[model samples]
Target chain A: MYGWIWRRLPGNAWVRAVISLVLILAVVYVLFQYVFPWAEPLLPFGDVTVDGASAGAGAGREEGAAR
Target chain B: MPVRLVIRTFSELCITVGAVIVLFVVYVLYWTGVKAADASDGEIHRLQDQWSRGRIELPAPGATASAAPPDATQEPQKSQAPQATRGAPTAPTTRSAPAASAGTEPARRPARSTAPAARPPAYRDGKPFAVMYVPRFGRAWDWPVLEGTGVNTLKKGLGHYPGTAALGGRGNFAVAGHRRTYGDPFKDVPLLRPGDAVVLTDGASWFTYRVDRRAYRTVPTDIGVIDPVPEKSGFRVPGRYLTLTTCEPEWGSSHRLIVWARLEATRPVTDGKPPALRS
Candidate 1:
């Protein structure tokens, strides 16, 4: 399995730790790969959507938004 | 010396050294892409603010064309808004400073004529932001944070959470990344059930949000999915809320995945040690 390969093809634990850290961030990215198109409809949330872009006051800042 | 004493000393040293090294690496990476990253960070912060507020009065409509910032303390002039030239040109000029404030502080740009057509602005201010990393996936391509509209940035972090909304002027903080395949930042996003933690930090504050509930609402029909006020926003305003969204499997999941979280706690991010990031 890929897990076995990963464990075997390693340097010292420090290098592995860094690699593991990267792996973790990658998994976080996977969540992004989904439902963008669907969620987009809510984009303007409550605004004037003229030609696929948002226009208005609030400008649409949400939670985890500024992240 | 007692083994316990020696072990404790060693562990503390390791942690200190580890923290130093992490800080060092973060500094280097930041230096390499300070302008872009910090701009994006500012944009995020700005939108986060806008979620509750509005454009903080535009600075003298037309200041100038363009210039560079000189001091380390003064805010970077529209530091992150330059990227706006492409996306939303309606950006107001402002100043920002990086959170690092270490090494060469992120230089500030001089105020310029608010370009009519701005590019996708990055962060609205300079806030030390850590890259969102997820384990259990590939090593080469950890998701990168971008400066622009919230949805796009969320995509860089992962894919858009199917049901959540992006940070902007909206009430609820909705984020989306990816699920499975191609640098899956939110691969386990579906795994996040209610009561689980969805952490968001800007290398400044670690905001802990507890997942309360998750449901699949047809993206277009789900108005209250992100209800910022949580009371209405039903063609009316509402209290604030949080939503984590993304695709289901990978292939064909018409059903949008949504995970709801409530603000539980917040703590400032250490100098360079931003708490681990999650979607």
Candidate 2:
């Protein structure tokens, strides 16, 4: 019965739909949930947060010089 | 096949970016570790010993008279300015120490050397430089008495020389330090009046540089401050000069406050050479 239901769904369309859901979930859980809290301890006053690329540049590289 | 290739390329791009991020973090951690290690070496400890106390009986003010850590292995110095944290150069820079915490300090601009006096100051006995005193800032400011160009020894206290003279192989031997911070070794440096003396020792010989003139000047990174004739030559002639530099405007200077002295005379370090420094 389950196989029949899954089989009824369009393969490519369902696959696309599932990927879209996973992407959205990743954004919410990984970025919003985990990242925001991780940064809160470093500089509490500033509300805006830098992404992985920008923070990596600041923490690891020289401030103004190019990579 | 084309779609699969596109996804693979994107994933590869992400991996490359991640690798770069890891490498950068490692670099910062390495330098921070190195700088920390350099600060506590025996040289610095010896310098601190020299600065902490002195035995020479200096003449009272106005008269040509005399003067005067720990490391967590990893953490970069939090309290000091970047220059303050760095060790002395093999040959230090001119010791400009730019005002910005992160921006580079321009090296001291060299003025022409003054003509050598009847008796050019010589390193007597074994002493190279003498301990000059700064009265106001109190205890923290004592420095070593270096013989020729002071840039190398100044690193023991001033951090690194910002430009040329720091190399220690050249014309005028220049020295530098902080004003109010870094123990404010040079905080009262700007207050030095004419006739004040900077004595240098080579252990056996002592040389004195007199506070002949003082001025304020702007310095650019490329400008060499300790050239044979480091200063601008207009009415002045050339010879060996000693310039003391620190921040301007007393408490703080957006620009440099400079005190230029000519080599005057030197005394020999005698059998009873008391500490040449005082707190």
Q: Cα RMSD to native, each candidate?
A: 19.3, 18.9
TM-score for all models, in order of appearance: 0.36, 0.37
Q: What is the DockQ of candidate 1?
A: 0.03
For model 1 chain B, where is the 10-residue window of minimal lDDT? B86-95
- Error of model 1, residue B156, in angstroms: 3.2
Clashes of each: 95, 48
Q: Give the CA lDDT, 0 to 100, for residue B48 in model 1.
A: 42
Candidate 2's residue-wise lDDT over B11-41, tens digit each? 8779756754564344323432343234324
- Those runs of model 2 whose alpha carbons end farther than 4 Å from true positions after fitting are A1-67, B1-141, B145-156, B159-170, B219-225, B233-235, B249-253, B271-279
* Candidate 1 residue runs with Cα over 4 Å from true position: A1-67, B1-155, B159-170, B215-217, B220-223, B230-240, B271-279
For candidate 1, report its TM-score: 0.36
CAPRI category for model 2 = incorrect
